[model samples]
Target: MSFGDIRVAERADWLIERVATAGTLVLRKLGETRAGEKSVHRFLSSPYVSVERIVETLAARTALQCTGRRILAIQDTSEINFAGRDKKRRGFGPAGDGKTPGFFIHPVIAIDVESEAVVGLVDAEIWTRAAGRVTSRRSRAIEDKESARWLSGCQAAASVLSDAAEVTMVADRESDIYLLFARKPERLNLIVRAGQDRSLADEGLLSMALAGAQPLRSSVVRVAPRGPGDKGREAIVELRAGTVRLVRPATVRKSEAPEDVELTLVEAREVNTPPGKTPLLWRLLTTHSVTCAAEAENIVQLYRLRWRIEQVFRALKSDGLALDDSQVIDAERMFNLTAIALAGAIRTIQLVDARDGGPRPASDVIDANFTVALERLSKKLEGKTLRQKNPHPLGSLAFVAWIAARLGGWNCYYKPPGPKTMRDGWNRLAATLEGYALATQHENPGIP
Candidate 1:
């Protein structure tokens, strides 16, 4: 079916609507009457509507309202663990766990760093291999077909992002090692935290170049905290500056490594911390030239934007969707389940963008359609015990859950017998609240 023809059902939209509070389980429960688990599953699993499209849609809508520089693309990965089994499956990648197995979700997210608004999402696979003792005795076995296919997932993701207006790949030390960034296609510029003692060619000392100059020593530098860094809050280090000219890049001793490229090393102050704190120093390397202090400062500011991905990760893992809640039995099904949850999270973000009233809400914005559907659901359960005792402010599911959890009847730990338990729970709650509403109306009919 064409995207335009897709119907916005009362139940589906209701599920989407509650995603902000009740989360995926509530959405699935809300969907059970109008559509089965399979239907909700299909809606989430289909690739036609992806996080990329959702972000792009928001970007396009925002673009019509404001204008700015070309887009800046940032790429990074996060680890999501799986309960280990003897073997792995397609789309599951290694997660750096030496023992228990896991997968990597490498997302290439683009944003207007200036605006802090995300505009695109591209995910790739990084499959894992069992470490020593988990697999065969042979130490250097080539990957079997199941794991080898992730190479294409990586390349395909890169190919799609190759055309971004301007691309900058950011990562921790893992991505800084020579192979991943240095060997990446030249079109991509990278800003990564470097590993200590990585190959380097420091040009002849600047004092040596200038006659009768005293040798340079450590200088005092002030470190100022900017906003949060990729890891956490960032600080700037300032020192007596000097420049180095590079004639050749540092050579890699290993034959398997990529060829070297030229880099200039300039040293500055020793910025140490209190007795409990460790000293800080930055030995930065980049393909871009640093002609002035302002340029150097901009690079550090840009790297700080890497923290934005952390927020996205939180949104996927804990913010409402709880993508990790899936109970799928195996790797393929687990990955498919993860992808579905990501779509739900992405949709929730879009819905919030559509409804957020500034930084806070001044009044109710739930549409008439959603309000009526909720009322209908409440009416349908009037005869049950869970009548609208004190119908939730605007009758939101979130408010209902809060009430149930406080009223001593709702057990988050309760395991329902089957899929029907969700609908039954809501019906019960509605019946109680509705009855209360009726009693109050009868008692206070003349007051209002």
Candidate 2:
């Protein structure tokens, strides 16, 4: 059924509200009552609920958020592993281990490039690989292969964000496909980490061609802590950039002819490393011009924002949603639920990121009733000192965020609240709102 259908629209609205009030918990835990549980199950099982339609609606909202702004369409893939628990489960494929059952989800998220605020999701695809379906990459067309997800994601984002003044597709090494560069749209630009060292037009390797250029500039960047027991450090890296024409590979689809593609290569290599740290080296291929060191650094800064999608994944799985613990056995139902969870995760990130600097209205991200409740709670949470007072304007996103952070145990002394803090705050707020509704109903029983 279309989104316009009454039943479909009502179910969609109900699911979104439930997910927002209570983060992506299991179906049984998500529903507050027996009737609510049954309704959610029926909605998920209905033929009218579709993952594509849900994603399209969210993408349309994201496009509206991107009006009159430049956005970075970041793409990445993460595996949803349900293998260890469900050996006999149908409609699944191999995961990290060949014997485990799981599927892959790739999503494209739009973020404001300058402010680094997450706008929303543009599109997403979920699929499973069939067992014993190996094929020769050399003989098959690009469209017939699984690697084509990269190109398809880019095309979808381009269409959805057509009104955006500028859209840059940011990806990691897995997106370094030769055919992708050949067929990329003119309006969509790419900045992908180089994965392969291919031959250049002048009979030199890509690495060798880049090595000839002298260092144009050096800059210092702060590297985030990697894992447990590691502290963050500042790194000094030298930058080098050059333009080259890549030679086409000998192996291609029979119908396709070889053509050279012109690209600008930017390399950032750490000059010095500490005692036990590994030096950072990144070779980036891009269509954007890098005429000066400032331009090259801008590309480097854009590439760094790729980690924003990683945060989105964290919000979906362990930090916020706990999606892996879901008990749904049906693949179709799980896919639909995953889409709703994804939208919830984006909302959480948007709130956390807008805590300090984003100047948007609170009504833009949250409801009026919720904001009113938060305002009442903020007075009790804030201290008498100015530093403890709300620094954001009333009715702004940062204002609500400050109230949530305080509820989550933030003392306004350390760094702003993270995803985990926001999750805790959201749970408390939802419960508080529920209590208020109950009290109001008891006080005015005949008003309704």
TM-scores of all candidate predictions against the true structure? 0.53, 0.92
**Residue-wise C-alpha lDDT for candidate 1, range 1-448, written one tens digit per residue:** 2223244233234334344334454335535555565565555455554434333333333333223333444556666665444353344444566544576565555555555445445543433454454544233322333322223323433455554455555554445444443355565555555554443334353333322323243333333433334223223345222333322223323443445454433333234455544465554445555566655555555665665565556667744455555444355545544443443454334323322112211112222333443454434433434533334444443333333333323333343121123323434544454455565666645311
RMSD of every prediction: 11.9, 2.9
- Model 2 per-residue lDDT at 27: 82
lDDT of 2 at 247: 79
Q: How high a TM-score does candidate 1 get? A: 0.53
lDDT of 2 by residue, 295-348 (tens): 888888898888889888888887678777678777888888888888888878
Please report, in order, the local distance difference test score of every candidate based on alpha carbons: 0.43, 0.81
Say which candidate scores most in TM-score.
Answer: 2
Candidate 1 at residue 134, lDDT?
55
Model 1 alpha-carbon drift over 4 Å, by segment: 1-22, 25-27, 30-34, 42-69, 82-95, 126-164, 202-236, 239-258, 264-280, 343-448
